[model samples]
Target: MPADLSHIRQVMEEADCLYSEAEVEAAIAQVGERITAEMAESNPVVFCVLNGGLIFAGKLLTHLRFPLEASYLHATRYRNETRGGDLFWKAKPEISFIDRDVLIIDDILDEGHTLSAIMDFCRHAGARSVRTAVLIDKAHDRKASPDLKADFVGMSCIDRFIFGYGMDYKGYWRNAPGIYAVKGL
Candidate 1:
């Protein structure tokens, strides 16, 4: 296989999407609007689920006008592999969020395992309010445990793997400016 986007493109062959840069920017603005209106100005803490949420967080922050703090935690469904492996709670945020409004942001909401876990963590940390935001919300299996329903959802996507706009395939495509669905893996 060739080096540039081969393995990645193969994985995306069935993805069937080609979002433009302008479209992505528009979505971010929409998410920011919801955040600004729904979230309070009481020192809200935006906790990003890293590796994918970094780009989304940055873009969302730029559009958000109110005062807010940011932090990140490393949650991995893949550990140096190209597949979704066991979910691991690795690095935890050191910021203080007790009695504060907390928002967990991620790139996509699939099985909802990681986000659900983080939501549970926020409760344990004494967050007065906890919410979730995601770029894509798929038709997740309802019986796959209770999903951490995102308070804010940008788009309702079919159950398909996607990359771009901060999403990735085998750690690639994270920097893809627009959201794209590859043909196959």
Candidate 2:
């Protein structure tokens, strides 16, 4: 199936820009600095949660300034729709993370179901430690776990349907210039 290009264009035209590209960049830099300070010497295995985490991880990795292994895992709940479902693993970590400090970078920490599951998987797989970094933390009470939180968060957003900087809506607009909330969503 092909995307309706006109609808996609209209969505961007009407969406509210929650954060500009510059703002997003600054936040990423800040998070990167914090991560570097804490994990620079840990030699962690960094996992980019695809496809949402793609843009964020790419930008964040440049600031680490440390020796670490970078890889990706494809696990998604929203296979491109607005709603999420059960976890679907398109790919899992192929690199050995046993006895290694692991960092999972993702686009947003919404309900945290996916992130929590990934963290647990790493722990069970013999990772010495597991941490998470998210570009956006949606402020809400309905989480997979009440205590679930990202170790590093680039920004906080109200509960809204958002897309851009790797986030998508109906499998489109991951390339939007900044963070945007769908009109009336």
Candidate 3:
């Protein structure tokens, strides 16, 4: 069933604000600075791993003062559901990754499935270097790929159901101004 507006509202109301808008922005600024320092001279192709990564990529890019190109990849594991499943590729980057420094940006790095898969894809496409970045890195030990982690992380989130600031609940609340942890989930 489609998520109703009232349900979304209730979820938002009951959720705990883990990070306010200002806090999130500050974290993004830090991530941007770090990215600039590390990859500014590399001329990286910043690839947003949509659709959750869209907001983060847009916000973070504004703070990055460097020469770079932008693209997007639409690979999903959670298609509007709480549980994850097999990977699905809705779209892929059009730019050639051969000998290019590739930066994959996403909202949350939960299990390392989607992000790790994307990184492998870039390498298979002949990328010289591939790095991952995330807005929130869930503090848990249940990652599907336990050895993988984000290269640049804005903040650490509690292991729980989360929404807001590009994260979502059943395809809603991605635009909730702050990062939130859902209550009773």
Give the alpha-carbon lDDT of every model. Answer: 0.79, 0.94, 0.90
User: Residues 110-183, candidate 1, lDDT per residue (tens digit)?
Assistant: 87766776788789989998898898787757524773578888776665567887888767878877777766
Superposed on all Cα atoms, model 3 deviates from the true structure by an RMSD in Å of 1.8
| After superposition, candidate 2 runs with Cα above 4 Å error | 77-87
TM-score on alpha carbons, each prediction: 0.84, 0.94, 0.94
Candidate 2: Cα lDDT at 14: 97
Quick one: ranking by lDDT, best first? Answer: 2, 3, 1
Worst 10 residues of 3 by lDDT: 78-87
Candidate 1 vs 3: which has more TM-score: 3
**Most accurate candidate by TM-score:** 2
Estimate, for each residue in 80-147, the C-alpha lDDT of model 2 and write its tens digit: 77787877789989999999999999999999888988898899999999999999999999989899
Count of backbone clashes, every candidate in sequence: 13, 0, 0
How far in Å is the alpha carbon of 111 misplaced in model 3?
0.7
Consecutive 10-residue window with the lowest summed lDDT within model 1: 140-149
